[model samples]
Target chain A: MQLEEQTITIDGQKIPFQSGQTIMDAALAAKIYIPHLCYHPEFKPHGSCRLCTVMVNGRYESACTMPSVAGQEILNNTKELNENRRALTQMLFVEGNHICPGCPKTGNCQLQAVAYYVGMLSSHYQHFYPYRDLDPSHPDYVVDFNRCILCELCVRASRDVDKKNIFAISGRGIKAHLIINSPSGKLEDTDFAVGDKAAFVCPVGAILRKRTRYTTPIGERLYDKQSIRIVGDSQQLHAGATKYGRK
Target chain B: MIESLEGKRGVPRNRPPFPVTQGYLNKPTVVNNVETFALAARIAVYGGDGFAALGTKQSKGTKLLSISGDCLRPGIYEFPFGVSVREVLEACNAQDTQAVQISGAAGTCLSAKEFDRKIAFEDVATGGSVMIFNRQRDLLEVVRNFAHFFVHESCGFCTPCRVGTSLLKNLVEKVYTNHGTADDLKDMSYISQVLKTASHCGLGQTASNHIADTLKKFPEIYHKRLLVEANFEPAFDLDSALEDARQITGRKDEMAYL
Candidate 1:
């Protein structure tokens, strides 16, 4: 049985997509950038960021979460939408202590790159300097809760990919934090390995590997070489395949 | 709300498998307003024809409006759905009315010119609330008050609602405190648009609704509050930034302040 190719119109461009693929998957596959965070190709789509929002049939829907319907009209990357995206990026910047220049993952950070891509010139909002304690309990990995965006990538990776259940998000709303699933509530106390998928799943400088700071320098980092739209995500590229990226 | 009712956090759930398909206890549930429940009860007792016979051609039955603010009769009044704002005001003995804030803080603001507008779904859709604002009332104060409400109520689940509300509150506070400039007013509109467009839930989406409505309908109030010459006012005051250090050292000296 042969199925006809399904296409969804984004910014007046008709891009073909598979039946089961989301708007993000189809758009990214076709090299169309719909700015998003908290959406990895390998993980389930979490529409918390609201950056990938598009006007679908006069209403807003998250592109990463919405299923691609044939002949559906989606408005993305418009002036109005880009402005809103910049505001959302600013919200993310103000939500945490995302000091890009001061962090080790400055150039390599997706949040910083996306901020640049969205034309976020200023923080725009008041900084929420919520006191967060740094976790140096683990000998090899340093956990900096200051940079966490509450994206739950590490939580999803530890639970789903590693099957270790090492990380979990505790509390609710602004009080929510990435918690280590150990009796002592520390990463070192858990049976977490350095090679775990959760260790490298962070899109920011929240989680860091010890003694690897400034190894590649700032300008020579992954995101510094190319924009995130071109390189997709670092996780897929380092896997030696472009499964969810340009082939 | 369903999550909170089920002993979970007060954060809103993401949509797709909506509350109809997957709600509290993962069962199909119909979430309705108190007014809607009252309507449902009335519909159950009286036939559909009886209810439909009242009001305008489009809107059916009566609406319960809790009329508050600068009105003489400050109580809930049951009027037909097509009742105009002027009629509501007259019924409540409201005098010298400048504007009418329909629904609630996150609803539309009607100027004296729009008093002819009716309380219908097609005309001025509201959940049955009409707060009157007389000529003596300052609407910017109202905006500031509502802004604080939204900031405290925000669940902080999503980035847009969580941060946007606080930003809106801060901006409104800045304006209220006379630290606002023309740029601050522009920034307020931009932030309001973002909150309206990208917020995850209705609370965040309509958090700045009254602000937007008042900005368009009553621009003078906001413009009058702006600085005479300054176009930019830094929210980060150098003196206020040293408050933590001042508190730590327990100093009242001028040098210790800044």
Candidate 2:
């Protein structure tokens, strides 16, 4: 693939990147991490999770959505940006059913790791404490609704890449739910089979490899301080791929 | 507060017999929700659509959201009505997988299955965003905690919420702690419906509705805890009976409290 070349400066560091890449892609390529949830490199950028927010020449923009332009000066990893990211992380915690105790994905989870990175120690707001459920019907995978942060990456991947069109969002706004195209609306009834990338698309432990839970020693699992790119790669990101490589 | 028609009378509880039929302060003052009054004031100030101009076409005026969680992003956001859930998340920079908690205590909990949904009262009424949680988080524990909270905070004016909430919390906690039987879950559901129908205050009535709604959507988790199968054990493990006693006595230090 012929790439369009471009140059941009992030956090005062000059970097060259392809023109078509989103600002987040360029930041990740340059190894300048800007916190984000919705934008992943392997899949198309949904830009729904706005953790990769940055300042471009003084205006706030999402690194995940903002395309690179030559000579563009971007400021990521700023204290202001970090504060915003911290606040966003806190909201996700108390909004729904997520309670991070003894969870298999605890330390290694992207949401938890990001919260630690941003230093969100306390939440002054009232807890929403929504009721959620776990979908362990899939023999190979699990879906824990409580832990879900509503980042539609899995939905997008399932539809766009997998072409399964199995997972679609239901309800509206705060009442939305993940309904399967089945009679019982359970995960077991869906078209998802073992080892499908769409089933493994969740960034949090909402989707898990069912039989593999606690089977791999804690230190050996994908989440033990290894970056997502290192632990799991784009090969498993979209459907029908199995390549996972270190960044 | 809705304009109480003139001569609207009677406090929720029976009137005190101190002055006989003469009520306290005579004029019968009415109390209203803060937001309700704010809306009333907005209607008077900007007219309907002008105030409505602040939000989406279907949802008018400003909405207050208190965001919290393990999200890559979180914070309170005020947007006009008709705002899509995606847009609200963008404004607050919320995580994608995180489910949204709707309304205040009287509202329901929403899951990711509903992300494409919009933000409107008719849609769902989460007054503000609390925190977001990831896969490592458990929804049952959160619901139990919230139920316990309502139970303790409830004024004993009514038996439904007052006693029902306390009972609901214990019942859900039993399930969470693994001691609860499948019959206990059935009893919890039955009691929840009874409270929803019979509770006097808003606190007792809808306190368990969220959990009930969740059970309706996902019954497997609740069923798994029943341990009907041979050698089946529950995943959650926090002592519910001891916790309930502690709450009742407010004495965690005493062994008798357990």
Candidate 3:
């Protein structure tokens, strides 16, 4: 898409991007990982999660939504930026119930992988230990509200691709949460099926299919096979029993 | 306000095409302050130069200040923009004033040393809300009150403001309640820096400005409250934690208490 080449320097490496592409889009297409959680290339970039915040000409802006300008100097992974990113990761960890060792999505979840990538050793801040409910009312799947990071991936995917509009984010600030659209607020009462696009977009263990919790086992999972930067969108590329369940 | 006028919660919308270009049900609109309208009518009647003849070279005209706290005259007062803070204090009969919060809870905290600073665009600018604190009032307590206000008022939209506001409040609590170490102050600087830079909107960005300003100007207020011999102390209390369980089980016995 280059009539004449346009480039932006990210952490001192010259990266070329076409018109209308964001810094995250160009960085990802160049196989350079900038550590994001809420951005999916398939859907419009929602800048909710500030995990991909980078220095753009001395100011911090989210790389996922900020359009790349040619000759702009950007710092993606500086020590200070990664330190801030780690703190943000820590906030997400403490804001909800995120017990990594027990979660079925542990080895492959993007939240866990990003935490590892940023070297977030602990929650650091005090944990809220928020009590959330589980909905196993659906015949084929379950919804665990505790593990949801409010990324809006399921909300966007269900509306935009599956056309069901089953999930929505409700509440404000620290009290914000994921909701299932139904009269009883149960999964079975809605038109959500096991094969909808929303079914595969969750990056955590919030949405799970029944009886496949340990299907792939821990060590051989998508993220376990490689670092998050390498095996980043393995879940988005294909759909199957073994997919990491992201898109 | 557009959202409020449209009968919804007043959450701010992201802008590219600003409200001037596109706003209020997608039509181009201009929103002005109430003061601006009053001044506009005066300008039309009296002409521009007559209205602008009062203040400094850069900052012109008079400002109506809604003042309160520790002042003998706790009411509205009109003054030109270039008036020194000490002059305003004297005019208001502010007795034993230690610190003057320039605007509101979100504005600058000017100590007695900075009283010579002028209230002008080129100097200490404000939106005209003034708060006077006497020497007896601990300025840190003023900040703590503001911190609590910010925590409840946060819209919880973005990550930094949603969580950082409460984090800052808790740090203030840790210090005032005597559990603070030197590290908590270090964390306050870092958290405020992130909040200032990374927030989605102005409310979140400016939430920590007063806290940062106070911490810089009045260091003794914080240092006096720190647990001197200790590097760490648990912030929350065990007894406070069990009060909910005590209420649920309906136990009044001594054994039920922590």
Candidate 4:
């Protein structure tokens, strides 16, 4: 006996998927763009960012975690869904101090790219502008909490791939934040190395290597030339660059 | 047990690999609501059908309602499901009831016109809270209170709920303070739609329930509060802040900006 091939329709486009694959995985495989953050291909689907929420059979579900069922009708890229995504992206911009113009990762950042893709022109809501401390104690890298979107990619990469267990997310809700695992509560005190997968996993400028801030000109960057949709995968750009210690 | 070990924020986790499959310490666990346990205990004594026969087919068993506000007798009332809102109000001896808020702040706020609606899984579902409002009661004030409650309770994990709650609170308060415009009311409804569809959790999703329900049922209350001028007014009044400084310096001159 052979297993049956299954297909799901997304925004009138029929896409095939194997069993145990999520909608996000199937969509990405078919080159269908679904705006998302905190959903790196290499890491587990952390549904903290609700950007990829799509209507499935008249109900909303995060495409990153929701498994694709055969003959399932999904509504993506609709006016209502995109409007909601824009509002959610705007909330992310205001929740933290996301000053894209001043940040070093303005052009290359996934959050910035996703915001642009979603057409988030401004933070519609008032900015929280919470004061977060910047940790530059690590000899080889710096962890700027201000830019952290709490995607937990570094946490997953450090624990799952690097086996360093140097990063963990602490707190709940808006108070949720990234914390260093070492006793001194600093990245330098932890066993994290510059070559660890965690260092290169951050989709934003939150985690940056030392002495390589302005190496790449603003215009000549990854996302500057092409949007995140053209790049296909967020983790791909920084995948082989880990050994060189630059994003 | 998951929340007990994970701390008391009461936020739920994603499903598929539910707590029953892989939970605390990567071990299987059983999670149930407190009411479920109580229902189980009652079922052991009364039998399944005995408890089930009391209410509607879809929603069996009795419901515990926490009714308060303008009702003459405001307290807990246990009644079988499928009871009408008017029947509940009559039982509680409610006087001059204008509206009923079912299921706490996140529930629907029904006007007197909807009192005939029954309480059941098939009808108006509730999680055991019903607040009565008299005709003299201000609906905007009720909405303002519910808005503030959500703002205080928001865990701030996701963007929609965290920021949306604050935005709802400000908009509701703007109407309450009589500085609201028609655009503000429109923005509130739009924000509510965004919260319901995009929020990460149920709290953010339902935070706008009271505001939305009231806006639909009682648009006049909001329109009455709208400023006559068509000009946009900021949420905050700068002149109010100057009142404190004016009093401290005791300046009555025109330059003092009084």
TM-score of each: 0.91, 0.47, 0.89, 0.88
Q: After superposition, how far is residue A85 of candidate 3 from its true place, in Å?
A: 0.7
lDDT of 2 by residue, B1-258 (tens): 111233321113322212234334544455545776988987998788678667655567887777666655566666776666666656666654445566654577667677567777767655655445445667676677777777666544333443456566767876786676766776577667655543444555577876787677656667777656433234234466468767787875756542
In candidate 1, which residue ranges exceed 4 Å CA deviation?
A159-185, A237-247, B5-7, B243-258
- The DockQ of each candidate is 0.61, 0.01, 0.54, 0.50
- Best first by DockQ, ranked: 1, 3, 4, 2
| Candidate 2: tens digits of C-alpha lDDT, residues A143-225 | 88887776666777778877776776665334445656677878788778765656666767787776666665666644455
Clashing pairs in 4: A173-B156, A173-B157, A174-B156, A174-B157
Off by over 4 Å in 3: A1-3, A234-247, B3-9, B40-47, B51-60, B239-258
Candidate rank order under lDDT:
1, 3, 4, 2
Better of 1 and 3 by TM-score: 1
RMSD to the hidden true structure, all candidates: 2.8, 21.5, 3.5, 3.9
**Candidate achieving higher DockQ, 2 or 3:** 3
lDDT of 1 by residue, B1-258 (tens): 799889865777777668899998888889998888988898998869989998889899898999999989999899998999999999999999999999898899999999999999899988877899899998888888898888777777677877877887888888788788888878888888888888888888898887788878998888887766488888888888888888899998977854
Model 3: how far residue A218 lies from native, Å: 0.9
Candidate 2 wrongly placed segments (more than 4 Å): A1-5, A219-223, A226-247, B1-258
Residue lDDT tens for model 4, A1-247? 9977799999999999878889998998888888888887766787878889999999998899898899999999998898888888887787789888999887888889888888888876656778898999999999999988877789889999999889877775567778899998998898888779898878888999888878889998878889877774455666474211111
A1-247: candidate 3 lDDT, tens digit per residue: 8687899999999989888888888888777888888888888887877889899988788888788899889999889889888888887887789999989887879999888888888888767788999999999889999998888889999999989889987787677788999999999999999788788878888998889879888898878878887778545534642322122
The interface root-mean-square deviation of each model, in the order shown, is 1.8, 19.4, 1.6, 2.1
- The better candidate by TM-score, 2 or 4, is 4
Interface RMSD of 3: 1.6
Supply candidate 2's per-residue lDDT for A190.
77
